[model samples]
Target: MRTQSVLVYDGDCAFCTTCVNFAERRLRPRCESTPWQFADLAALGVTQQRAEYEVLWVTPAGRVHGGAQGVAKLLLSAGKGWAVLGALLTVPPVRWVARGVYRLVADHRDRMPGGTPACALPAHLRPSAESPATAD
Candidate 1:
């Protein structure tokens, strides 16, 4: 059985890898970060499509939070100023805005520093093309 939460990200994206590295070095979030391509998605109860779409936080109990919520959960686990920020991100209006901001950044990640064209989500995997429930 799992103990710590697993942070699943797109390892194929250099920008994503860079962000994860920064989080590890600076934020020190309490989780094991792994690229989805290298993870056992089935064991983590994550789908390939979903993993490809956004960052994922998979709790030991099997709860899966994606995108901005995933980021919030990661921060919450950090247990400090980051936890405070994570709490703020979960507030109704703040959560909504964070979701939008996360999407905006994710949509343009391919243009971000260290990012490559491979960082862009495929058409079928885009949020507009596939809903969360159907992503799997």
Candidate 2:
């Protein structure tokens, strides 16, 4: 088993990097946060395509959580007040809403503060349940 969980994200996206920086600075979650470009996805049991599409939380045991679920896992590891918010996020009904919120934020990230056009995934790279993040 791996010794630590890893948080993987898109370093190329300014918005994404800023968010990660905020999480690291403020949330202080106890995990190794790395840009997917620098991570060994195969070793983390994460696929390059999936890493390109969404943020990921790769557990020490090799289980992978994506998008909003991954954020919840990250929060859970942060301890104290963060764990409470994380627990709330995992509640079934709340999780569904969180997923939608995450998707919306992802879709418009290019327009967010600190973001560049590079932060927006082309429609072709958007997430879908059937094929992960494949386009229509």
Candidate 3:
């Protein structure tokens, strides 16, 4: 059985919403997938600006994932055919490719659904306010 997992997505992006909606419908019964708005993330302790930038997933282990890894983790947790895709994406060569692809998608998100010219976060999401480093 799958433990509780949370997928933090950009609720404002149409493409993201479409993909998340598809995941919600397809991954139901095996996992729980929900749309998370910027406000929702801020309420969860993620900054509004941070949440607007990348896709986040809170794993069953309570660890957070971002970027391509986050998307693969979500697919892994979802089970079904996606599990295979996740595995493939996690492979060394594929992982590199996946990261590149993720960057492209993220960079061009403005053309996607729910995307706005000002949707990107000014800074990377920090685990804590005091943390100096950031992840992209």
Candidate 1: list runs displaced more than 4 Å: 121-136
lDDT of candidate 1 over 36-120, digit per residue (tens): 8889999999899899889999999999999999999989988889999999999999999999999998889999998887678
TM-score of each: 0.87, 0.86, 0.69
Quality of model 2 by C-alpha lDDT: 0.87
Off by over 4 Å in 2: 121-136
Give the number of the best model, judged by lDDT: 1
Candidate 1 lDDT (Cα, 0 to 1): 0.90
Which one wins on TM-score? Answer: 1
Backbone clashes in model 2, listed as residue pairs: none
How much is 49 displaced in model 3, in angstroms? 4.4
lDDT of each: 0.90, 0.87, 0.67
How far is 125's C-alpha from truth in model 3 (Å)? 18
Query: How many residue pairs in model 1 have overlapping backbones?
Result: 0
The better candidate by TM-score, 2 or 3, is 2
